[model samples]
Target chain A: MSVSGAVSEIVAERWVERTLAAYPAEILPFLSGEHDRFRNPVGQVIQESLTTLARELLGAMDNRATAPAIDALVRMRAVQDFSPSAALRFIFDLRPVIAEVCGEVTPQLESRIDELALMAFDRYLACREQIASLREKELRVRALSPAR
Target chain B: MPETLVQIEQKAPRGDWRDPHVEFRKGSICYSAAAKNLGALSLPNPRAWQPMDADWKLPPDWKRIVLDGMKERLKKYRSFRLFMDICVRCGACADKCHFYLGSADPKNMPVVRAELMRSIYRRYFTLTGRLFGSLAGGRELTEDVIKEWFYYFYQCTECRRCSVFCPYGIDTAEITMMGRELLNLIGCNTNWVLEPAANCFRTGNHLGIQPHGFKDSIDFAAEEASEITGLDIEVPINRKGAEVLFVMPSADYFGTPHYYTLLGYLMLFREIGLDYTVSAYASEGGNFGLFSSHEMMKRLNAKIYDEARRLRVKWILGGECGHMWRVLHQYMDTMNGPADFLEVPVSPITGTVFENARSTRAVHICEFTADLIHHGTLKLDPRRNDHWIATYHDSCNPARAMGLLEEPRTILKSVCRNFHEMPENTIREQTFCCGSGAGLGTDENLEMRLRGGFPRANAVKYVKEKHGVNLLTCICAIDKATLPTLLEYWVPGVEVAGVHELLGNALVMTGEKERVADLRGELFAPEAHSVGSASEASHA
Candidate 1:
């Protein structure tokens, strides 16, 4: 196997594993249970997105794949009862997981992880904006007179 | 790679759920009921309070009043008593709740949510509990327990998805209703529920729209429908000599997506030439009182029958709504019944007898429309709705409470060519809630609503991925109001519409102008709605 291919597999598995750890313990069983997409969507989304993210982080770092994956996972977290740090900690936590698995932090991987974090931050803000906008829309609709 | 990654902690310590220590977060809970609303209803212990405040300013003897209320209700309601008594705690219902499925909060599990009340019942009402106390799985009633009750009971949308899976057939929604009623005695209620109910009792509708305001809203919708259909549609409101009285949730007129459904109703009524009159006095069919208490539900629901009597109508026809149908189907006849003044509901156009609603004298609009289609009364061009690849969401009350499963699907099949069903576990009798039903749909509680709605949205995402489904048609007014926001958050591409909106789009109205756009003013061009292109289509 190529050195990068081996690194991607190891890093991807570690990333998914550490990310699952970040959820509350009560939810851990559901998140780590047998992967049925319909039955366990939160877990399924997290796993699928993280797997794609790990691959992208290690390889091409394609925005097309990475942005949606980041969006899917972060939107779920954004609406959950987590503070800003706690919600985004999983992204930042990836740095240490990669280092621990590889025994040394490569500058290239470090830069890629930083870039992924910025993408997640952007997604987090967008999700919050959508939520606030939705709230405003609901209030407008709940009124007696139509805006039109 | 190591066997495990990064010192994994497999088991997180589980805390005692019976501790009754609830942390009131900002978005998880709703604001307390306003004093003016409670006083408007002449309800007990009306005072301004917040869930986050240390003092709820409950009655001086709140415990005594609560226990007394529970005692009286247990004596009166056998369903509530049976639900409290018969739980085997088999955990069959633990994961069935959407909130539990989404949030993974243990207390949200159906068994535990019911147990929040059951444990207290075991302590005071049952023999084993009074004797053995903690040993009998009972805890003393404290102020903290009341807070926990307020927090968790409102968290439940009264969906009853769990009751479907239970071996003993426990109706958990009734238990929630009872819990809220008990809370109401101590004036522990949410403004979202009480304010609307107070408005409903006073001005005849939840939004407190006076007769003129209600007429203006309906006139606006009728004008919009006329413009869309090119037919001059005239609606009769509070006409004393109408054949049938139509009652809709106020949101159907006031809310978006819901307003589209109203336009659909107007077009259908006009096309069929049915002699129906809309009642502005009994304007709202959805009883927020159902969320408050049985008595309040009865008070708010009495207006429908009263208006039917005043108008000398044969029967009542209810518009698309969830809890409204629940109140109409399960409780209305019992609560305010012997509508002996009204005749059984039979469709003037189809001549089909609604025998199921004969006693209640209130027919669902879906049942009526489905009958019309069955009889080949209205001309429908399904290609008009070619823009939508649709799926049906069976609103909780209609599915579990009333068994209104097939009528909506039958209507969708007739109106739209591209139709798909969500996963078997998530549709038709086993369907999940919009998570904001039963007065939980409020701005302050958006986070919990999002989490609670996750399961339903997840299922929608499955269909969106598999079939490129763009439209979710439901029969509930609350579903119409809340599911749009829920989809916007989780599954962005899928838009929410009432079943009638699609019907309106597809209905080939007589003497109607040539149509260029669907009911929401979107183009009917199939090219604009290619499969998998819904992600880019923005809905107003």
Candidate 2:
């Protein structure tokens, strides 16, 4: 179930392809083809680096490693001002890509990967909700302070 | 020109007196009699009220004009675009609205309130709306819808309390501003709001009460202040190079009870020996009616920066008014900027800097007083305010909107011996409007006034019935004018006064002995503050 370096690039490239495919025909012309020309390669490198960091950070259980990786991913999206709904869209877009790229693997491996994706999405959602709550609290404190 | 002016004056009715008591209330106290008889109050002269002319239609291309203007204003901001785009229509903000809570009306729902502008935004700007039309909840703009927009948009106090609970962080105040901007593009503005804005544009004050009237009002207030405190307080006006410019709403200049708070400011400034001057030109700081439109708001506020420059004041002290403070705190800096001549005000008495200041180094009157009290420069006899159970109504501007909740309370607690807060939800950011704020405080809108004022009046009534609270204290000038009218309608016996009025009553200064008779009469009843022993008092 571990995504090696070659497997990570294969997964990311499939994600980008699937995301570009989901747009309606009218919006196809507006799609950037790449997320951002300058950021895409660097972003993929950082995302993979963080996945390794999450594995090292979590140390023992593979299920536990999945949660930390998803948490880190959610934190990254929040720093970019991505809402939970938008985060969900990004995850959903990656699904068809995962199926297409990982289809030739064993059925058992495919089910394990699907389970990991679902678990990661749930953890990402929980992190997004936590971030949103913190943001709301911060806003309240700023509003209640004398010097708003 | 003179002939036309004379003709217009002749056509305008000369003070129609329907009921002398009503006339007395409006003319002297500025208490809108409409607030008293909420459901049945009639216009002062029905003849004077006319529907818009049949030919008065918006230009055929009004939408293009408004959208172009909005695009130009919003071109630089990506966040504003996102804010406009991301509303999920969950009804959390509906019950949280003070107006909706009071009125129980479906249209007053915050989502619907915001949708007045949002629908228009979608219709004109979004691809979904351009494709789907009414199915996408986009409707064509018509005169009727515009009128409804005006009615509900003006109903909002722009208090921003609803934004606190909004799941999307959607600020209804921003939507209200956009609504006002669009309304202004078509010239469908109220005479009360537009005329005052026009007056402020031309004469630097909303009332258009000329320099002589300004002087007269100030001198009269100073005389009253002198009568209360034995000091001959002089309220200097338009004096160049003054250290501070005291800008207040025009209502404070002419409105009763509000005039008392103005006098309190005068006495405190004189007592502390601060170099300040009132601007004869820019007399009003609050534009409650500007809740309707940004153009009207900008027109009214245009004088503030210019007047400060003309007077060469180092700092401006905003009077205790609700919406005015909201406008000043929220948009003054953004709308009128680079006021490099001004510095954030350091209290002359305390030497403490006001850290929460925005745009042109303005300070609220209560913040100024709290600082003065902190410095120990303001002589206090807190016992003077002990006769009545006092509760503070945190005006919406200073509370949830601007976060100026504590400074006023600090001053009140220090000055008043017995100070209490109303229920928890009824104070600080959750505080209710005095029903008459955001220009609905006028006599013309009786039903709307009752709906808006009900929550605030009910809260004050609850405290009064339960705790024997007789007086409601707030810092805003509009609160003084409007709360009294509302209390008369709902609570019947409760009195509302400015926080500074209580401070003035408690102030102990040089020649305090000579003013004891006047102070005792106003501050305490004969039975409450008898000087003689109990047996001697009984005999007397």
Candidate 3:
């Protein structure tokens, strides 16, 4: 792997660690155990899901699966009443975290992360659109049926 | 000295950790349902906003509306009254909760979940609570508290597993239902559930499949069933005077894994030549309203009996679904009818009577099929499913609510050779929710679903490692949709399927050709069969 690719891996792990650190430290360890069933296991599931998305996002891989993963993360964020800045910031928040980890990086990685932020914004908007459309469905489609 | 059970258990991942003080966080909270869906239901005080919004725009009379709603519900449901009035806080139900077990959130505990409402019930209804206030575990109903109601209530799947261990039989499902109903009075309802209920009310199915579209789906399933069996079988749609009116979850007709289960029903009905007719008007057995309010549940459920009487069917045969049975078995007769117009359901082919469902007079498909298998009505080839080591997931509603456990397993044992149960605690009445039932199965709530579904998945992982069990057979439509993603994310490659789907795969339909693939659409080629069997055996 290229030096930057290796750097991305280190930064990605650091970023996931940093993002998880944002929550209470007490609950952080349970994040990866898939079999940890309980009430409101949502906390751990979100951490693990975001961790995967962060790693895959920072690596800047062109895998198609990443799109849905990104969409899912944003849907979770957008549905909550977070400010647009706070909701989308997790993707862009990688910049400072990555910089602090890598010490120094080329503009290519930086620009790529910026592009991902834009994609994250678009995906977030799409989730909002879905919510809006579903809400409107009751009124607009009462007479005419919408195809599943 | 021998190592004790605790020491041995401590050597691995501990399942019994207890945090004495559990705190709440925004982490696992669900997004607020949009205002329009609530307005569509004509609920009072609807407004557009998110759960995190600073202002919820409550009507001036919101408090009165809620208190009045509570007053009315208490009178209507004796269980609600008894549950509310009699709770000694035994703490027996705390660890028993899958959500509390999975997340360690105290509020997720059944007692704590009820306390959220019971505290309010105390604040207004009780003498000591009103005087002493917080000291008496009572609090005034406020906006933040309303948000808490939405968060915790929607968080619950209303599985009712906690009710079993409770000394008072305090059903949290009833509390959760009442919480949701109270929320609905104020126009707080989730769109994922409201949309499906509305669709079912209008189109007779959750997916909103109109009569023609419903016919198209049945036609397609018939074609595919023929492709597998080489027997062209046409399913009846909306024909009167049919002996039985078959009802099913609409997801079976539309969703991928679920559609395969639909194919199973088609094949099973054909094999017995059952005198049944599918109705366009009462097509849905899965009631999304069960996730919402009682009135909505009744409105959505009334169509089934109405269509049955119109079609002149003597009895009803419900398909493989979890919560659908909860309604049909427990609530249907009370909410919908005397059903005196219809006769007791008896299998014409097997000569077996469903005495358990004598009052409701509706037979679960598993019970019906199990009876047929016992009577040797059809030849089942177990080797056809030699590749899968299956474990049965007793979905929460059917197992706990109605006790329809052994019927599915009996059918599975008859059809599939390699069947195992998950660890005893996780099966039967103690089953975990798919994490996304009761209307929280939307994309937005994916994180919550994954976590809530983790305990069940964790138990599945245990079996997968221990027994090499690859197939997780369940009989819930919500499980069909949610478990696939939940299991795939947590324990990949272990899949979900309905019991009927497996039976369809194993059934040697008369005059049928060699099966090319199982119901999952995986190739069952002769060459792959030996290799698959060898590998699957090694897994066991």
Candidate 4:
């Protein structure tokens, strides 16, 4: 199997196992809510990105259509407390994941990693711009608010 | 090979509740209701302003006004005092809240959201709180506290799921209502709610359609229903001596998805041959005034009884709606009731008595139909719904407040072949809000609605991925209008429909022509086309 597909699987299944440990025991129990992704919609979203990222790397797909979906996740991260490096850091995590899964092709996946990071960063900024516009709108409404 | 990827820690360093630095967040907060809308509704202290602003333009004595408002409401609603005093902070209600579960903001927890108001209640009302202040969790009724009340109170849809799990039955809805009542004294309210309430009060419908306009819209829908059902159905409007006075959300008359549900109502009424009249005077079943203060809600609710009395109907047959039924079942009886003038609603077709709604004498259309289905009165063709693998979204108010859960599902199972449920926690009693509910369903507040809707949307996404369920059928008119946008964003391609809309597709109407296309002009079934050709020949 290609390293990207292997990386995708590990992220969806393998990495998710470890990431689940990141939350507290208080939050861990809610992973079973009826909506399948109750406590971990982001993990599903992150897992969702792997296939498209993997597909894009193999020259079988373009992220143009997929960018909005990816950007949605990035937008959440950007507005959240995650620092810029930390927010975009997940894209780069796939590189080492691939290396561990298929050690022979770690260097081969570098360009793909770089490309995905750039796209993610661009998407994050776009989301940030949307949030900024909303914030601006809120301000405008405040300014135009009915006076006493 | 590079070293292995490490798992990112999910927990924050301190696990703090309040982040004072970003308290006025752009993404997480809701926008204020506009001035013109509030003015039209004739709300007290009406003025437009954003919650994020430092200056809310309160009156000179806003503090006294709010404190008095709280004192008045506390005396009126024992639930308010009970909610304030009973909470032991056990946090069973923490994860139960959809807002907290979606946003991970600790303040979104039901206990904390209620605590915002409870804190003020403690400071002003309790002796220990008056003495100890912040030490006893009593916060002064500062302008910031008012701002917080406006922010969080609007954030709540008042679904009362928090009260369901509370041991003392301390309803957060009571707290939120008291918070909003206090906010109203300070001229803080959302425009989306007030405008609709104002419009409904003025024009007899929330959309502000005049009598002729309301009639024209229903007639246009009746014409559309004629196309689907191949029968000329005359929907009675404002005719006296009708056995039933039918009402639904005005959205059903004007919009897609909802309009189909409107068609469902028409076809079902025709098949049963029930004598029912739709009222242009009391045209709306869904009350936006429910989201506003109780006085406004009572004013809006008075019309149903008035119209029902004027028209001299036997009982009210309510259409598919969420908060509408919450008002009809829970509040309407107490507010403007003793509906003694009307007879207890027994289904004309099945002859089943609705004992649960005996006092209000209002029966949900689903409960009416579920009896018909159970009694083998209506011929429902389940094969007509082969195109849709449906899932039920229990709109919050009906499920939690009234327990009107089984009737809709019973009808769905009888009418549709493929039915799957959302996760147990997300359906019936534990159902999440449509995000835009409780008067938050406006375009300007789309971002907050989207954020608020994430948990519900996430659940739909899972069912789409696993069950290949394409249709998200609900019983709420607000759900019909808002859930489409929510689903389109989070789980694209999963279309929403009403429970009646599905029943419309599956209803075996008397003496109907050869059916090929379902409502929305889609094919009856993908595979049925081959067999349909043979049936066409046989019918000819």
Identify the candidate with maximal DockQ.
1
| lDDT of each residue in B185-231, candidate 2, tens digit only | 65544444544555555556666677887898889888878777667
Interface CA RMSD, all predictions: 4.8, 26.3, 12.3, 6.7
lDDT string for model 4 (B452-527, tens) is: 7777887887788899999999988788877876676567789999999888877777766657777788887865
Encode model 3's per-residue lDDT on A58-123: one tens digit a residue: 565565656755765665556443556756666766777767976755597677677778788898
In CAPRI terms, where does candidate 2 land?
A: incorrect
- lDDT, candidate 2, A46-136, per-residue tens: 3443445323322342655555555544443432213345544545444455557655555555455566557657766664465355435
- The 10 consecutive residues of candidate 2 chain B with the worst lDDT sum are B19-28
**Chain A superposition TM-score per model:** 0.90, 0.49, 0.69, 0.72
lDDT, residue B29, candidate 1 = 85
Q: For candidate 1, what is the total of clashing residue pairs? A: 0
lDDT of each: 0.86, 0.62, 0.75, 0.75
What value does the interface RMSD of model 3 take? 12.3
Q: How many clashes does each candidate structure show, in the order listed? A: 0, 3, 10, 3
Candidate 1 lDDT by residue in tens digits, B1-540: 787544444333357889898889987788898899989999999887799999988878999999999999999988888888889998778778888877767888889989999999999999999999989999999999999999999999998899898999998888899999999999999999998898889888877889898999899998999888778998999999899999998889988788889999999999899899998898998999899999999999998998899899988899998999889888987899978899888899878889998789999999999999888887777777888899999999988889999999888999888999999989988898889998999878988999999989999988999999999999998898789889988888999999999988877777777776888998886653332232332211
Indicate the residue-level lDDT of A86 in model 4.
Answer: 62
For all the predictions, what are the DockQ values?
Answer: 0.33, 0.01, 0.06, 0.17
B207 in model 1: Cα distance from truth in Å?
A: 0.8
Please tell me which predicted candidate would have the highest lDDT against the true structure. 1
How far out, in Å, is residue A134 in model 2?
47
